[model samples]
Target chain A: MALTDADLVARVLLDDDHHAFAELVRNHQSSVRGVLRQLTRTDVALADDLAQETFLRAYKNIRSFRGEARFSTWLYRIAYNAFRENARKRKELVGIDEEQLQAEQDTRTVDPALRHDLMHALSLLPLHERSAVLLCCQNGLSHDEAARVLDIPLGTVKTNVLRGREKLKRTLAAWGPN
Target chain B: MNEMTEEDVLDRQLLEAAPYIDDNGFAARVVSRLPAVQRQRRSMRGIILVGITALGSAIAYTLSGGGRFVNEGIVRLSNFPIWLLFVFAFGSGLVVGACAVIVAIRKTPEVRNLRRLQS
Candidate 1:
């Protein structure tokens, strides 16, 4: 069997093994990048940059990782913070404009127009609701885990996911067949 | 087969759609940015060893009558003036208090998290 995350963490911590850390980055990069993409409203380049920052921060603070949570959970927390910080900076520079927000949400390059509509509906969600829904639905994190990643209460996470799903359903209802 | 509801169809479509961007060298870019891990570990080990050695020397000095020698030296400086001694004691206390506050701040979770991000 492949080494567990705990084993990889031990190698990185005890042996300062770069290969172990590389394996970690390889394993989790997709999920981390995906979450950031969603959180950043599909700003792929910015998402990738934040993902890189997240991994570097993880490596620097490897010693501080107390292992109380799963390694992935801790990494997600860091990614969430990185995304928030980057978003804050961007907001300060140029407040989120509707046209730019719509552009950022347009990820489907060749898909049908319905896909674009779906993405637009998703983009209409409040940030917390969007993050909560994406973390729980697309990213496959449990509600509790999503709560931890978003640094929100469990009830708030539940409320966001429920409200987000309802909004998506309502917004897409126009396209629904009679 | 059961008839699919509209919500079910939409949910399936959303779930099946690829949500993540394809990793075209993203991992390599991140790995390249990482610091030299072995070198960092070596330097950290050296610092830790030096710290332990310094702490041990200080303890040994205190146990080996260095404490008394320092006390005697301070006593000899008593010839300066009573007010001078009080000012010296207050200055030393302020320095010690500041060092303690710095160490405590470094140990706080928020500071540690900020340091990790900044690093």
Candidate 2:
């Protein structure tokens, strides 16, 4: 059987063995980086810097891992907290304008028009709503799990998913459902 | 199968289109720095321990020879076994050494806890 995450993390912490950590990082890099990219949309360089910083912080703090949640969930919490700190430091509040949202919508060349509408709808959303939607829809997390990672209530997670979907439906209608 | 709603379709696209970035030896770099940091911490612990050892021996000798006060209790306690004292000193030194190394080698609070837990 493959080494469980807990076992691997224990090894990483006590032994300073990067073998297990490398496995974890390799497996989750895309998902973790996707979250960073979504949060820091305009700054690729800053996003990359923050992504590395998040892993470094997580490794540094891994010994405090009490196994209160799944390791992936704990890692997500770290990423979320790190992103929030960077946002606060940079004063980069997400006040997404419709025009800029439309421009972001138009920049994607590869996605279908419907996909673009959905992405546009997501861009237009308030930051927390967008995050909840992406974590639930894109990342395939349950509302409860997303709420745990976001440290919000389960009800709020459900509400955000519902409202986010409804907004996407309206946006797709405007784009005429290709 | 459940229907893929607009949100679902969009999310699928997002994941498919997402870019991957590597951390580039971040873990190795951090680990590399640990030993030197640990060594520095170990020596500091050693100094404190040495000081404590020297102080304890001086106090024992001072009391044994002729302390300023002729307290009877002081006289008896000072008559501790030389063998026992040697053992105690050795044990204390070992403890001080372990503590010194532990303090020096640990990188984070979590790592420190990990060491204690592992032990």
Candidate 3:
């Protein structure tokens, strides 16, 4: 059987095991990178850079992870902080060009244009709503987990997710039949 | 399947839009970027050694007459002439200062590495 995340976390803490840590990176890099990509307005390169920083920071601070939440949630918190830090350094987070995002998108997805539209709309969302939706909607984290990752209240996470979905609905409804 | 509701359709769309990203050498790149763990392990071993030595010393000190030795040592030190006391203080300060300098010199590389990583 594959080792559970808790098992992997234990291995990392007990031995500073890089193999275990690498497994963790492999296991969650998709979600971390995907969420970061959406967060960065589909800037895949910057997203990957932040994802790398996330894992490194997690490795340095793994001892503090009490296993109260899933390892992935803890990682989301780190990844989110790394993204926020980068944005803060930039003073303002600007949306990237759509052509770049459209070219980089996986052609395999059904309705690639709709997906592109969604990605663009998500990037245009208020940062809080974008993060909340990406975590709870895109990444499938529970509202409470999203709250923890966002360091926001449960009510606020729910609000952002609801508001974000509503905005998406209205946007899609207006743009229609793509 | 029954037609999906707006909420359900939106949720499905969100999932489809942000499907699992592939590794595509990302994991390898991240793993490669990690700082060498052996250095940290070595430092941890050093800390463990110092802890063990301190613990052993404490056990020995307690097993012996801790208070009596402390009082006697203080009295003996107090009995030294002022010039000798000044010399001892100066020598201790110099030793501490030299050790600090050595430590700072040794740490320069790690500091540089941290700055590089930040960039």
Q: Which candidate is the best by TM-score?
A: 3
Off by over 4 Å in 2: A1-3, A16-24, A97-124, A169-177, B1-47, B66-119
- Worst lDDT run of 10 residues, candidate 3 chain B, spans B110-119
Candidate 1 error regions (>4 Å): A92-120, B1-14, B38-119
Which has the better TM-score: candidate 1, or candidate 3?
A: 3
Question: Candidate 1 local accuracy as lDDT?
Answer: 0.75
Q: Tens digit of lDDT per residue, candidate 1, span B1-119?
A: 33236545655655554354566777778778888758776789999999999999899788968778777886799778989889999999999999999988765544344433333
DockQ of each: 0.15, 0.17, 0.22
| Poorest 10 consecutive residues by lDDT, candidate 1 chain A | A103-112
**For candidate 3, what is the lDDT?**
0.80
Query: How would the candidate models be sorted by lDDT, starting from the highest?
Result: 3, 1, 2
Write out the backbone clash pairs for model 2: B38-B104, B41-B104
DockQ of 3: 0.22
Query: Which of the two candidates, 1 or 2, achieves a greater TM-score against the reference?
Result: 1
Best by lDDT: 3
- Tens-digit lDDT string for candidate 2 (B36-98): 334456679999999999999889869777654557765765799888878988999999999
